[model samples]
Target: MIKSGETNSRSFPGITISTDLVITGGGLSGVCCAITAARQGMKVVLVQDRPVLGGNSSSEVRLWILGATSHMGNNNRWAREGGLVDEILVENTWRNPEGNPVIFDMVLLDKVKKEPNITLLLNTAVYAVEKKDAATIRSLKAFCSQNQKEYILTAPLFCDASGDGVVGFLSGAAFRMGAESRDEFDEKFAPSATYGELLGHTLYFYSKDTGKPVTFIPPEFALKDITKIPRFKTFNAKDFGCRLWWVEYGGRLDTVHDTEEIKWELWKVIYGVWDYIKNSGNFPEADTLTLEWVGAIPGKRESRRFEGDYIMRQQDIIEQRTHEDAVAFGGWSVDLHPADGVFSEKPGCNQWHSKGIYQVPYRSLYSRNISNLFLAGRIISASHVAFASTRVMATAAYVSQAVGVAAAICKEERLLPADIIHEGYIGALQQRLLKTGQYIPGLVLEDKQDLVQLATIAASSELVLTGFPGKPLLKPLTLSVAQMLPLPEGAVAPVVFHAEATADTTLQLELRISSKPGNYTPDVTLATRTIPLHPGRNCITLQFDAVLEKAGYAFITFIKNPLVALHFTEKRVTGILSVFNSVNKAVSNYGKQTPPEDIGMEAFEFWCPQRRPEGHNIDLKYQQGIRLFQAESIRNGTDRPAGQPNAWVADWNDPQPALTLTWQQPQLISYIDLVMDTDFDHPMESVLMSHPESVMPFCIRHYRIKDAAGNVLAEKRNNYQTHNRLEFATPVTTDTLIIEVEHPSEQVPAALFAVRCY
Candidate 1:
């Protein structure tokens, strides 16, 4: 018989750790919980399995953050999720213009380091959970790389934010994995019976655009009837090679259970597919193509889910059940992969809703058997069908945020997992979510005196502004009648602010000065020269010497009235900017072959749809205008030039970056024009904020910038490489303004792009 182990003092021999909450798994869910808990004045300890903070969405998986609000909506920003998610987006958009993975790691590290309330332990793995009693887990044993020793973390509350639900499994919390038969939960998507069958896995890779001849080949495992099995036809590579490849199998096989085995299959398929294309002569450019990424770590879509008080079933999602205890919402359809262990072209694999979003109750996130433990992410208690939809990372982030807040509430009230329902705390929890800037569709607000008071205070204290470069002034810059935003009450809110403000109202902002740290030279230094500021609305101007010998970027921060709006404008035609990522590795889009007459020129088109694309502007007044893609130089009129290759590249010289915009003049600065030029595609990266008038000249000192409605803007741009001049035309009236340039990239040169005010 296996006897229960005791937590001896020797377990935590040399650790000086302290925190009110300990969150495991630094993935989307874990990080969200950490950020939320830390913001609420709770000491937080966050642990992760990987070296980086983003788990499946990191370079490890190469998966982008997908959400319902992506590319559309008033907050059509890179990522609408706020707090930690927002922080990550801002860094990706500006600092890593090339979408460098290293930049993501650094950004996460910097944010965690800056927060005094957060204690981060990297390269750590949790091995065991020691509980003092059936209701409470006393400590957790973790192996750390830096110390090369084991340590125990003791906290009042614990969260299984790990996407794998490791803590729940180790703590003996009831959990389920794989598929459930259709009749089990009456889920239309469920299998005949809940079985251990799992979704197929993948190892995603990318190719650079290099104009060259390519040939296609057949796979060694080429089954003539492969498409008949439902997987082969998903990807359109007739020769079985050289395309967007996805090779998967039943992840439950023991012989193939090892991570290394899974990784091997992925690689084998990747090369096999390439070989087929090359041999078949179907992919002429495959010969010159470069692999930008091999298979990232195998991303397991569905796994063990911890059983909670209320299990989310397929019926809950299909019927769009509105639970009285709903704490979060998801709009994604019930997307389920084939269970037959092969890629299927079956028409009925995924499900979508026509109207309202699916609601997730609080009881579905915490363990019913464990009192002190709560779970989030894909592993939250849900039937197999439900897991398929909620498995996406964006949805996971919201769930994680909810977990963090609920944990805080549990600690403060000294309540058990079951007690939360009786206290009517779910509504309070929903309010906290709204305050954080995440949108939970169909959230019905319950009346709470304290919540109303807090919301009122937040609304009143917020700054609302108009025009770019809104800064403090020696006199009030009168707001033009056209520049004012429609306010509900007499109280105004800050429309767009630049910097993160401190308790004392100090603004902190970062500038991109150099690509590499060693580029620093004392002779060419940057010194801040501040301008005068007054009340109402004003602009602060900062002047510095642009004497850097090499190309790079820098950061700046200043105070301003919150009501003004500073629109950032860019005109880039052919290069990487802070905004966009190239679809392939080439600056220009080139197909392998074309008709004989159009031998060297490749035909392409560019469409912006409106004047200002969503997330391109903060005020939401302008949508992008459709423009045609015009090539300055081409080998031929309609075919790719013989030597011109297509590749995924990033250009940092584009006008758009993580720029903090404040109003310089309210009336004159009505609309902004952004233009760009790139070799392959146009990528623009910038942050847009809206706030009340009182919050002018968004503070830049504290490394935080928000819009008038408290929405935090975050962006991620991968299109890099290239050099081209871009232009931005923003109307301005007031004198003196603060413009903070934001650039996030590993290889940004000296300030080659500048702003010209007309």
Candidate 2:
């Protein structure tokens, strides 16, 4: 046990504890950071000021968990923040579909608590720090308001994930506050001149109907005149909780120091808004509604951003620049809110999107002045314009995961945060991250330690026939539209699609190949087929003897037939393309409240009314719309990519598919990691929708591994895990390893993503 005032002077009364890593803040980023480090065998001490784990996502503040996927509304197709963030999302989606903030807090708390090496201190605020030298933080002093006790935590490495970067500030680390001038970083999105204004803070409230008429009495602190607020016109009393994100304030003042003042102002606005809803004769529907909950603490957006080796700028996000030392990626648009926030006359914010997702380098995650101080979340080095995109809770969680993994490597090698970037350790770090399911765009997992990469791969079935059990079109299209299906350069089989009809109908299907590369529009009709469809599902086969000269899209257009309903999958396929030619000017409300912005400007016009791009392979799902096959899934190292399908599938007739890895020479290996495809049909955001099962039925249920001599090395029967790691008690030396996969009794083909050995 740590004795009181042992490490520090008697003036500082606290229990002194030593750990390898010390993390401040219990937000999503901090929680993920501590969990990642602890899981990697590092002793972690997590100090969170709030009792709950999630900061903005906590019930205290009540913000939904959003990341790079942007609710799957943006054009950063198939982009989702992976690793720990994905884990939390998947778990939360399965456990709490209501999107309850209290359940989300438990999910985060449970994840951190499961790590044996993590010591979580809740309601503990880090107020003081001791410096080992000019460049290193030696220890931190925190006081837990809940327990009325103090703690002195000494660590070799320190991570400041605090939204306000309190640790870095107290440690005298170089930092910047507020916006920078456009000339400073050459950022076009930056303000014309420097300003101290920030993105402001938000307070949310939840309301419910009380069955009978409910009366609301206004508090004395509430604002009297609601007409002063410009956004008051958009206010609908029926919209409660997070839907009122525009109920924000304090961007014109200091976001951190002036938090109390901001909170008071926000309270006045919230109460006034509620009063208008209850007392105003305009809202008759609110007569039976009562305020269920209102947040006291405001969810802050920006404050003190620390200075690091590399300062991310708006150009990097706009250009979608790739960095050599990229450890994480962000796909959210350059979402910059006006300084006036709710009071602004203009729209709440202006968003500029990139062509695709952008990379975040390791150089921007460590303090420039304080060598041992690693930064995560909003504290990372970035100009205000760049921070606008990376400030979301999900993006911050990804950043923290990277920092946690990097910190583990640093502790293992006894190196500082900067050494990982300069000493050529980034490649290893990236590889490790990939193995853990973190998707870094453009960075393929090519670990030299992976024995499968050294081997010549052969499968029981090499030819992947397209258009089997085609994706079901949730919303059938009646207009004469074409769907683009990506065919591999070398073609071996014809495409088939399954469709249904309300009545006996005849439809004409035309297959058109692209005239130019990267173009999905049909240029010339290669083949045409006129077929009659039945009432229920029927497989329509089109036999076209044509070899795709290059990797391009095949546009399949179906003539308008009111009785015929074509099938398609919401899950996007890597090379599949979908487009529709419709003159209907009716706007599409494809689940998202806002339009696709500039990201989907063109694609929206092509596939308007439905909004989703056409290109997903035509594959029929199981009884309840469960996807069964994924192409190009093997060797990708990731099973799912947001709403995209990413697993390889075999011909359903191929009962026992064997994936063989034959190396040139016999190698000693002790560990193997295997990842399989779980259906991506289930939506991650299932607040209004719920899925029956978390694991897809198409997952491999049974598998066995054997050596060249046909000796059974290891086997798993009746397995349901998507990710399986096998560790041999003793090293196995073999030139050839065979992994024979058995499909479940459901008749689905086996799908695998990665076969890694170490």
Candidate 3:
């Protein structure tokens, strides 16, 4: 190779690329959007400024992704975001149970690389936008610093997922940089100037013990004094990384334009905190610890929020209001951080949780004025109060998945984003998202192409919920514990709880359900019973004498009794879980959420399930068997547990549980999608959190499908994913199909949410 001296200021190489969709940002939102669009047969160009994907979740920032499950802190039962986000999370759990940030990066890269239709541009920043007209985007001019090349990306559709609204800003899309006044949206949760209008940026660091004493020298730039950070005393030797999410600042500054300044401040803070630990004589444990990693960039929280047809407000989240164009859902509390961050003497954050998961409308996904422009990630159309709940990585990803599918619909139909609703394609969009395993609150998949619906189905042994068999394991009722039971709308059955008490005491039993159907929060109490407990083991009968008016989950709550120890079973069912009214400090849940009276937030007790190997079902006996799990339940279309446990669970004793579908005529089938359980209640954070198990305990590990002649159609083993889509090498024509599932483990029973044959 020969090198030539540059004459004048020669331009770097430039190229033009055209695609069906252009998604700006390599964060989870854009990554998921590109993946979804690529899977839907759209050519997608994904642009990122960072070398890696995942943005805040990348190894550079190292923030663990969290969303609706809220670390399983709030009362959101089976509330994990579905679709590609769920797939990514499940894959991460399987591949990197250790939650290594680098491994997580590989997972996102692997997913993007496997999609043939997605052209990912790493280290590319979109600097300019070309508009076809005042309302539509024509193309984006982006430059890749690594290759020193400029790219002109053209697409009919443009989705701006860049965390700070880079594309939207360049396109002149309507946006707001700070919080709106309370009068703007009539939002009571609107923060005052003192509390802060925007959440701040956070920097994280990791420390590891070297087994031998290590010394650290601080730079002159490091903060010399330790007391500068009011919360510095709360720091421990083991606490590191995003666990120090409160190590934040710069909300009072321009979050986008002043990002460099914010990052520098964070760097100074990081080194200062490290220096304090090493030399301040407070942490002796730091003698053997060394900084393994410090974030290269600060994880940004709030910034520019764009405008759409509908701006998500505080009421939509707290009231769980339905949206006609509802395409997504979120359950995380309205979490806002202080503007002063770690420097402020106030608490790090103010959070207000809703009663249940609420729907997100498609109207809020596209720029109101920019016809072809889509808003996603933290930049989506939402008021300050609403953005807090929607800003999390997974929630943003889930919403972006909708944008991806909307792009596909738009491309195929030659329609604009608003036409998705105006032209009556919204239902089609929702159904398409559901086909991809995305769950929208209060919506069920009604696909006419699903052949399983037309077939007559019978199960080998459907679970009649008489009760879980007793185990030797006994858990103290130190806090209120409840068994979540699926019930019918008719006469209620009495239940018996076996318990041992250190002293004779009275046990208070209450039956509760959510006020609204399809919500798991036990906000409405239906019945109560007082039972006597003896010093020795006692079989207490709780006769509620209550009759339900509608079918839903019933919480048989055992009030806190320190003297009583109730039996818990190892038997795990797909949709059934035992919940405790307790605190998960990680998410700042302290049993009950009693927010300030004027915030327009509801107060409710958080009855959340524990993670696997720990969340066992309560051992109890049903006076009358409840047949909620029938073969017909699978065809109802609702996959995950909504207000009800939308699953057909096999009996615990059924050794060879199978569902056989017999059709009147033989039909050819090309593909089949089976929806299994992966413990949607578990958050499955992609980084920094070590899960109890790689595969969800409720996931069916082995399953087989057979045709009329008993020929094996397909067999899956060690399967941990929630969606199992199987395409045949050749079309299989059969009048009868049988699916047999093996229990995931000895503790968990086999369960199926839905079966679709196309």
Candidate 1, 88-179: lDDT as tens digits: 55445556645555555676667677778888888889989999898678888888876776768998788888877778888889988777
Candidate achieving higher TM-score, 2 or 3: 3
Task: Write down the lDDT of every candidate, Cα atoms only.
Answer: 0.47, 0.73, 0.90
lDDT of 1 at 197: 57
**What's the candidate order when arranged by decreasing TM-score?**
3, 2, 1
Ranking by lDDT: 3, 2, 1
Candidate 3 similarity to native, TM-score: 0.99
- Which runs in model 1 stand beyond 4 Å of their true positions? 1-18, 70-79, 96-99, 145-147, 192-196, 209-246, 251-258, 278-280, 340-351, 442-758
Best TM-score goes to which candidate? Answer: 3
Per-model TM-score versus the true fold: 0.56, 0.80, 0.99
Off by over 4 Å in 2: 1-13, 192-196, 454-463, 470-486, 489-633, 636-646, 654-671, 678-722, 726-749
Q: By TM-score, how accurate is candidate 1?
A: 0.56
The residue pairs that clash in candidate 3, if any, are 518-643
